[model samples]
Target: MLKNLAHAHTQKFGKGFNVCNLNNMRAFFLAFSIWNALRSKLSWTHYRSFAG
Candidate 1:
């Protein structure tokens, strides 16, 4: 399912939709499932680091 989703996203968006990236995105979403819990002052890099 991820492979198919990634392929379709790549076909439409043209880049940055590989399996590894999809997995990272899934992990990020799982880690931060609560939108209200996210800190607005933090950058994406900070959030990514936290997710990692």
Candidate 2:
């Protein structure tokens, strides 16, 4: 499913939809599953660091 989604995303968006990025995105989503639990002042990189 992730492979298919990655292919479609690349076709539509042209780049940055590889399996590794998709996996990281999934991890980020799982880590921050609660929308309100996110800190408003933190950037995505910061969140990514925390998630990692």
Candidate 3:
């Protein structure tokens, strides 16, 4: 399973593989949203990593 996942990531970033998985896209969007919120001092969703 690890090997398959690694291959998927390699193919995903390689040439001619333009499709991005939904999970990856969601994560990318969420990351940017968090960054923007931090920079703007705006309301932000809770980050579980930092939550008690």
Candidate 4:
């Protein structure tokens, strides 16, 4: 869950989050950033593994 991760990161890092919340609301809880990340996680990981 991005919410839990973001919460943990916010608590750990303390302010200055680069979270840019967009106004495009689709689902009740789905944010634009999170939706994109979840959609691309698999390919992103694959690309990272190959690159690294």
Candidate 5:
């Protein structure tokens, strides 16, 4: 199922649509949403490692 979704994403979005990239994208958005809720003033660079 994940492979199918990744293949579709690759076709639609171009390269770097593998499982790791997909999971990273998900983690980024999840972290972004949480940051928005908390209104963190920290720079993204500072928390980038935590995001991934």
Candidate 6:
């Protein structure tokens, strides 16, 4: 099912809209969620520096 959905999206959108990008997006969201949950565990400045 997921493969079919990806194929359909690629047919409409062309390249750069593939499984690798989808996985990267998933990882980004997962990281964002983890960051949100830990926002208060450390200083905002520390996080900003680490982000850089």
- Please report the candidate that would top TM-score against the real structure: 1
- In candidate 1, residue 50 scores what lDDT? 91
Q: Over the stretch 1-49, how does candidate 4's per-residue lDDT look in tens digits?
A: 5556556767888754323221112221332334544544466445344
lDDT, candidates in the order shown: 0.93, 0.94, 0.48, 0.43, 0.76, 0.63
- Model 5, 1-52: lDDT tens per residue? 7789899989999999998877876877887765456446766565568786
How many clashes in candidate 6? 0
Q: How well does model 6 score by local distance difference test? A: 0.63
How large an RMSD does model 5 have?
3.3
Mind giving the per-residue lDDT tens digits that candidate 6 earns over 12-45?
Answer: 9887667766665555555566654665677645
Tens-place lDDT per residue, model 3, 1-52, is 5446556766877643234443444555666656544544433344423321
Question: In lDDT terms, how accurate is model 3?
Answer: 0.48
The root-mean-square deviation over C-alpha atoms between each candidate and the true structure, in angstroms, is 1.2, 1.3, 8.7, 10.5, 3.3, 7.3
lDDT of 1 by residue, 1-52 (tens): 9999999999999999999999999988999999899989998899799999
lDDT of 2 at 8: 95
Off by over 4 Å in 5: 34-47
How close to the true structure is residue 6 of candidate 4, measured as C-alpha lDDT?
A: 58
The TM-score, computed over Cα atoms with residue i paired to residue i, of candidate 4 is: 0.30
- Backbone clashes counted, model 4: 0
What global local distance difference test value does model 5 have?
Answer: 0.76
Better candidate by TM-score, 5 or 6 = 5
Candidate 6 residue-wise lDDT at 48: 46
- Ranking 3 against 6 by TM-score, winner: 6
TM-score to native of every candidate shown: 0.81, 0.79, 0.26, 0.30, 0.61, 0.45
CA deviation > 4 Å runs, candidate 2: none
Give every collision pair in model 2: none
| Least well predicted 10-residue stretch by lDDT in candidate 6 | 43-52
